[model samples]
Target: MLVLVFGYLFGGAMTVPGGGDYREFLLPGMFAMTMLFGLESTVLAVTADTARGVTDRFRSLPIASSAVLGGRAVADVIDSTLRLVVVLLCGLVVGWRWHDGLGAAAAAVALLLLLRFAFIWVGVYLGLLLKTPESAAMVQILVWPVGFLSNAFVAPETMPAPLALIAEWNPMSATAAAARERFGNPGWGEQSWAAQHAVAMAVGWPVLLSAVFIPLSLRRYRHLSR
Candidate 1:
């Protein structure tokens, strides 16, 4: 919520030729950014369990091995959804209206949940791979760069040409773009192949990430238990 508020304040500060309402333009990105931040909780919880040997205890239990990870994933998604709702309500209080009707808003929420689901798998993989809270803590620093490099806070065109190219292709950029378009934010770049591809990539990424990581993480868990 602080991040979203700060982003609105920062957006309000910028001077541009075709100036737009910063609050309106920024709210969708803030929504996406909030979900991006939620991955930290997943990482922390998983790493903590590993560090305390709670995961090992689960491994030795009579329950199916998948239950341990599956339960965590289910719980994380519920928690993330609640957080998104609270942040959206905060956006509403700050003059961020949803110009796009109910359908678009619903789709936007679905996309956010999809992103969270994908990141859960990432958290699982990281938790299983690192096996120690300190190791995971060191690697988790990359989330900031990944979050900042995309269109979450500013227009990708505002970045240097080389960096702009990379930001343009970033997955979070696609998610932000799609959310902005759905939310009716102004000053978005010209609709190009990138914009068109963003929708597909945004949806496809979570599915692909989950497919690859869930099995890999489960396999790793099984091996560690033996």
Candidate 2:
């Protein structure tokens, strides 16, 4: 809500290049942002379990190792879905409407959830790796740069050419651009390859991240005994 308030307060002065309502552009990015922020909570949750020896207890049970991590992933995804819904409602209340059909809007939402799911593994790995709950603060601090470095609050075009390229390639940027495309909202619409193929990049980024992180998480989980 604080982000929304600040966004609106400053949004009036911003203009989306290629012409579209800033709120419309901002809201989709906000959806992606909400999902990105979930990384912090997931890290904290897993870290807390590790700190309290809850994970150790689970490891002692005769359950499949995968279940331990899977359970956490399930709960986080549910929480992320609820967060997404609340943000959607808030976006509506604030006058950000999707121009696309319901089908497109639903697809956009699916993409958002997928992004969250991928990040969950990242959080899980980090949680297992960090020695203490206090260390989760590192991930929290890192989230902001990841969130803002994208085309979430402002278009990448407004950034320096090199920085804009990096932002355009950011997973968050791809998701935001893809979500905007799905909602029939405006985007940076830059000529860069990433900007032109937002949906592909959006889908690809998460899948790729998961591919790398899922194994790392499982490996890390297995080696916790070490």
Candidate 3:
């Protein structure tokens, strides 16, 4: 909420050349940013469980192995959804609107949650690999830079060619672009192929990230007792 308020206060004043309203562009990106921020919570939760030996205790229980991770995934999704709702309501209060109507808007939200879900798997893998809440604290330093380097705060076109290319290809940028288009918000009128087909990338990136991390997380979990 504070981030959103601060983003609106500062970012809403800026506009991409030939783009629509800055606030319109800012909101969808903020939504994507908020979802990405869930990475921190998931990382901390998994790390804390490991650091405190809660995971070892869980493994010793008679419960299904999948239940432990499944429960964490479910809980994270619910928590992320609640956070998204709060952001959405705050967005409305600050004059943000979805011009794409109900179905598209719903799809945009589903994409945000999907992004959150994939990041949980990444967090799970990282937390177990680090094996310490102290090392997991470093994830914060990495996450914020990745978040800011995308289109969440400014148009990629405003960046230099190299930086712009990186931003354009960023997974978060794909999702943010897709959400903005879904919500009928402003875009930087990117001419590149990636920018033109953002929704596909938005969906594909999360699936790819999850496919990579889920098996790794599961394998890591199974090997933890070794």
Candidate 4:
């Protein structure tokens, strides 16, 4: 939570002229960042347990094998919810408001939670695949570049042509664009397609990612115990 709060504050400070009222732009990105951070930590913890032979002990117990991974995912979701509350409170303190009213705000939060759920499954798959703390730590380094390359801190158009193209297609960019519209931010572009497509892509990616990773993680978990 501190990282996200300070991250938004620092990001807001860097973007002059908009810094005073940039929460509309910064809030969604911070939410995404918080989710990603939580996902990475959950993955790391699970991988560490596997590496330390804790998972072996759990496998020997009479408790259902699914309980191990399921419990971690559930606990991570609860933790993510708490982190989101903190981030939202900080946003309120910094003058963030949802102009599209409670419904839209709730939808935005729901989408964020969905994204976190998707990532949790992805983390589970990765944790089981690598089965080591070192490999999981190495995988986490990719998060920085992925987060930065998206429209988290700047408009995609402001980026160079090639990079802008990549940013536009990024799920984070789509999520942020949808969030900006929900917040009633001005100058969100005249074309409706960008926003429409962004909303679709943002929601779709998480669904697809979850569908793919969750089963894979479950299979890998079963295999590991055999």
Question: Which portions of model 4 show Cα errors greater than 4 Å?
Answer: 1-20, 62-65, 186-194
TM-score of each: 0.89, 0.96, 0.94, 0.84
Q: What clash pairs does model 3 have?
A: none
> Over the stretch 154-223, how does candidate 4's per-residue lDDT look in tens digits?
6767779898778777766677666666656432352335545776877988899888988898788878
What candidate 3 gets wrong by more than 4 Å, as runs, is 7-13
Give the per-residue lDDT of model 3 (tens digit) for 1-226. Answer: 7766765676567766685677778888989988888898888899899989999999888977578888998999999999999889888887788998999999999998888899888888888888888888899887887798898877788888888888898889999999988888888888888899999999999999999998898889989967
Kindly provide the TM-score of model 1 when superposed on the true structure, using C-alpha atoms.
0.89
Residue ranges of candidate 2 with Cα displaced over 4 Å: 7-13
* TM value for model 3: 0.94
lDDT of 1 by residue, 83-151 (tens): 889988888877777777989878878887888888888888777777777777654486777788887
lDDT-superior candidate, 3 or 4: 3
- Candidate lDDT scores, in order, read 0.77, 0.90, 0.86, 0.74
Better of 1 and 4 by lDDT: 1
Q: Name the candidate that leads on lDDT.
A: 2
Higher-scoring candidate on lDDT, 1 or 3: 3
